[model samples]
Target: MIQYELQQVTQQYNGKTVLNIKKLEIESGKIYGLLGANGAGKTTLFNILSFLEAPASGQVVFAGQSVFFGRTELHKLRRRVVMVDQYPIMFTTTVFKNIEFGLKIRGMTKERRQAVIDEALDMVDLAAYRGASAAELSGGETQRLALARALALSPEVMLCDEPTANVDVENQAVIRALLTRVNLETRCTILFTSHDRLQAAGLADETVVLEKGELVDTSYENIFSCSLESKGKGQKICLLQQKIPFSLPGFVPEAEGRDYRVYLNPDKIKLVQGGQQVQQRRGVLFGTINLMMAEGEKVRLIVNAGVMVTVLLPVDEYAQLRLAIGDAVTLKLKPDAVEWL
Candidate 1:
């Protein structure tokens, strides 16, 4: 198992700053999700952390030791930590031989080598391809082959970059399943990057959002457990040390229909002036504005009532209303906005 700590990691390319992470820590035995928009330094950070590239400054501490530079120490770290690259290499050999490459390099005997190779193949469900040419495999199969090769080494930690990038839908599930099984059955820890939220939601214990190399936020289930769901209650919210309150008009009567489905158009919502619920209660409190825009001639808004409510409004109308960012207005949730959800 390996514990990696990075502080003030920064990188530059062609005079442009590529990454600037202030601090990050990875514990042993946990799967972490690193997500960001394209070109947000995801790959650059990955390269530096995996020891493939150098950082302008800062340090990476692994297992209580600081790794600054030098091939000797870098090679040592490379051997212990394996990265199944997005585009993996395949030597001109059979799949079995490719999987056995690391074992051979590590000087394992023939008996031990075969056992490790077989176990790795079985782990990835690639036993059937043992005799196939490594280069002839499909995109998804290639990724699996890459995993099998990495597994044969039985690394202390594995970093998978875009493992499912070129995979077919069916094979994507296969790869995820294989990765999950390996994480549970083996002692190796995994830190992977994924574009699929649903996949990350299920597989990752913690998801760290990266913006331009810095940690923007980390998602956790309990973060919102205490906040006012409607927040519209505004200053009325109590604090062992907080007080104040803003009264709002009564809730709109439910539209007679199936369930209301107030669609919160992220674009349509604007910060308005006056009657504005306190900034703290901003997320909730929905209402429609008079008239509409290039969009529907009319717009609607609805506030959800949980322990509080979730606010939603139409995009076009919100803009059409010409409402500034802190103004309060009435919400006319249509029959479509509310539902069992």
Candidate 2:
């Protein structure tokens, strides 16, 4: 079932268009990672989804019904859909009271509210802090508390904006686990925004990337500012950081000397150690592996060759290469790896 459908959704702020999504469909009971940089219309889209603000132009369909901004019972819809902000606010009260307040507003009986609070706290692993003051909790714990408050209502949809952005590493892991557990156990639909490419790929079942207030048909990794330079014979070189160059067929007209952005899919890249017997190819890039992180069956490697580039490789392939951090490496971009954004 489709949870939310957006058509011709456009939002503007102070006469400047901020978001213009032509069509989007959010499926039910799935985790979607809204990937983008800051001010990529993520919060704007969230405002509309949470029904806090309506789009200037568009049709919003929720739960198989068209939503009319003023005509719809927005307050009621908000109860079924909750948003946890990047910096979650804490009530100047006990953790238990914080979770209890929302339930009380909905007229839940005392007994029912207590049970719900217990479950929500346990889900976020904040049961031990029930009597603790909400304002005194650590950043991560406070974030979990915000989630608990939302969970207490058993919302059908949860919107988390940079949930772990301000948390400690330990809390980040805990919060990630909690989200996965909640989705698996309760089957609630979740949409979260994150600038971390690996985190988004690891957590979300699907990823929606936004660039410059518009949706882009690619993941949000390996994006670089580039300019095209004509290299004779109807070929162009896309220069990154004015150093690394990617040769492309000059099929695009009026591209020379003009600024553009390019996206290199991590999965489409192959990394090899510096001394590997790889041909001096058009797409081969030299860099040093600055970081390597395990992502389930794949390993995400970050290489610094003037510009930071991300590459994804299967665990077996990574093991075969025997690469490590600080090792000089060569990234072989496949023929179709370079994408114009």
lDDT of each: 0.64, 0.87
Please list the residue runs of candidate 2 whose C-alpha ends up more than 4 Å from where it truly belongs after superposition: 225-260, 267-283, 289-301, 313-328, 333-336
lDDT of 1 by residue, 213-233 (tens): 677653211111121122332
RMSD of each: 15.1, 3.9
TM-score of every candidate: 0.65, 0.83
Model 2: worst 10 consecutive residues (lDDT sum): 246-255
- Name the runs in model 1 displaced over 4 angstroms: 218-341
- Give the TM-score (vs. native) of candidate 1: 0.65
How many Å off is the CA of 183 in candidate 1?
A: 1.6
Best by lDDT: 2
